[model samples]
Target: MSRPHSVVSQVPSGVLVVDKAPDMTSHDVVAIARRALGTKKIGHCGTLDPMATGLLMLVVERATKIQDLLMSEDKEYEGTLTLGVTTSTQDRQGEPLEEKEVRSFAPEEIDAAFGVFKGEFEQIPPMVSAIKKDGVPLYKLARKGQEVARDPRPVHVTKYEIRDIALPEVTFSVDCSKGFYVRTYAHDIGQHLGCGAHLSALRRVRSGKFTLERAVTIDMLKTAPREDLYKAMISLAEISLMRGA
Candidate 1:
């Protein structure tokens, strides 16, 4: 027998807010949200590594229109840097290539180190990233043990504040325009300090006007009913109006 009309009519449409968990890629979240909503019109604004967590913006059905605008917006993150170690990837996932005994620094010294990174500057993205080169992803080439020169692109770090100066870790907040690579920023700063550093943990707190405050965990999203799924997704026009205004 054919399905009831009420069932077809009951599907709601909107945006979904996901508090991405550590170790789960952003694409994994989209797949789960797609199955949860029972529709194919689900998409995410930007990519986040599996090691990172916090705000991961998603759109459902009509809301998918907003992804472009959201992708171009400023981002805010709280991250921790591991000193005395340098990694190939500039993040904890990579193998450590060098280790040095680090000298602990005062808050003022930490601030000064990052002050050089703030404002507009050119940045070269790490090889183990999604950025493409000559029609192939750089990460693909990197995995094959090949290296290539990458042009530095201009990026702006509006705010780079040292929030804590714990012995081995430096916790901080970084606010930047679109296209900024916090990983490269950390690596270069480490090089400048003469102790080397790598990103240990990162959590995106804000993207444009959408904050982690409104994000729900993946588990919570997985348990939500199909009809309720689309109801949670917000539209691009809505985000544009909210962020642009």
Candidate 2:
């Protein structure tokens, strides 16, 4: 049975850069897009945590062909982490597993902590992540309180800068290869600082060459007319230009 407003033939196929709102899964955005655009052929290049916000690339219709290529692109993010507190999910959304006193650290000290992780390295993804184990997602096992060994995967960070430094909270920006978990980076950096920590907040600002400059909002997706959405979409020709073809 075709869903309501089924007009797959009416809309031109391309990419939509969404300025995703917090507290919603990536799938939630796609579901809304499917209804708003009145088409089922939609997918996201990357998945964002429910607590995350910012640029989320939605491949619509024929644009789904380049989803894998887009997914493999390096990513950029701005995030904050709280020191002296570690959570089960390595983020504020998770259970507070432990907490300790957060003492002051010199800027050099913090820089030294982030310095070691700037280049190529291996990172063990958080158990709450989307990684697979035995053909089942690791998050599913984490729900059952199961802990399993996971081999670390190689990752590369092109750049990172400390934006703010205050006791218990730090803001920073990072550009890294695909599959790099910013939460894990925070956790490991906490270990380097002799204080455990968890990601307090996160926002993706860029993916590959795409930025959040013209991204549409959730409200726009839900309330705007389909014609308006098509106006904001990146045409296939534009994508080809970005690819230097």
Candidate 3:
């Protein structure tokens, strides 16, 4: 008789939130988690571009069942954008395509530009993105210098607070729905102000009910003993309790 999958499984089910460091792909964190947790059934809630850092939630074992559901909720982030350049990827990781003189855009002017995107709108996904086209990732096409038409996706930004406005670099926090691209938000704001722009830095701070306060650092994930890692897990029961509340 064939054995059932869970009968042979050894790991518990829960969510593992990691404070992902900059320059690490979300999948790279997953690989480290898989090894640290000793299970191949782990999956992250969403992808965080390699250049961006912060909370990345991983679903383990049976928790993977709710991955898509968890991924569909709103998220919060803090990011910095430089107003003098536009990049191919809409972020710092891509090639710089254009540069402009960043004249002193007054705080009121900057606020007005950001105000244009305060609510729901259409956003064209950048070419250097993981979104697929005919079974190929757009980033692969972007690597070959190929461009393709992408439909505008509807996204909503519930809250955007400017934390600092230091001329060319603006730092801010935003609460936006799933699939909202902060890089694109910056680029469009630049376009509005006629200065061009690109995302210089980004850090995810929250996703739905989960926050970075409950996250483990990437270093701990890399070197912690398996038992220690298990203790860090947010049990499936806890997750249920969170969702119910």
Candidate 4:
């Protein structure tokens, strides 16, 4: 006869808000959480690019059921775009493809160009993205020196504001619907400005009702007491409340 599982091995069902560090993939966070929490029943609501950092919602145990619903919610991000440079990946990770002189522009000019991006528009998903083509992720093909034609995807940019600008670099925030790619947005803006551009940095600050303020870092999970770690978990009941919010 086999022995039943112990209570110590079974963690409570809930969501864990994580402050994902730069260079770590979403799956990397999930693997670390599995070991820290002592359970393999862990999953994430959305995938963040390795170069992007910030709030990542992880569903643990029975909380995994709501992953799809959570992923479908709108998201907010803040990042800096570097003007006068274009990259193959649309971000700093890729090799520089082109460079142009950064020309002077008024704040109003920048705002007017951004205004054109507001509301609904069609965007081509970046080749460095996880979007699949022919059963393989586009990034895989990108790594092999391959480029494929992709259809433009409709994306809604509810808000796009330039917070600050220092010539070659522009810092901005965006509130956009799911499936929107901020890297593509930056690329498009650069094209409109006639100077080219690429995403230099990105941080996801919000997802659905969850925010980075409530997230815990990997270091915290590693050093906190087991009881304290449990305290950080958001129960599924709490998540259900967000459905109406």
Q: Please report, in order, the local distance difference test score of every candidate based on alpha carbons.
A: 0.81, 0.92, 0.91, 0.89
Name the best candidate (by TM-score): 2
lDDT of 1 by residue, 1-245 (tens): 22122244444445577889999899999998776666788798778888989888887777666578668989998899888899989999999999999886776777788998988899988998888999999999999988899998999988877888886788889999888777788888888788999999999988888887667778767775554554555655566577664
Return the top candidate by lDDT. Answer: 2
lDDT of 3 by residue, 128-224 (tens): 7889999999999989989999989999999899999998999999999999889999999999999899999999999999999989998788776
Error of 3 at 194 (Å): 0.5
Return the TM-score for each candidate structure.
Answer: 0.91, 0.96, 0.95, 0.94
What tens digits encode model 4's per-residue C-alpha lDDT throughout 160-221? 87999998999999999999898999999999999999999999999988998779997876
The TM-score of predicted model 4 comes to 0.94
lDDT of 3: 0.91
Total clashing residue pairs per candidate? 6, 0, 0, 0
- Kindly indicate the candidate among 1 and 3 with the higher lDDT: 3
Weakest 10 consecutive residues of candidate 4 by summed lDDT: 1-10
> How much is 26 displaced in model 3, in angstroms?
0.8
Candidate 3's TM-score reads: 0.95
In model 4, state the lDDT of residue 43: 97
Worst 10 residues of 3 by lDDT: 1-10
Query: Order of all candidates by TM-score, from best down to worst?
Result: 2, 3, 4, 1
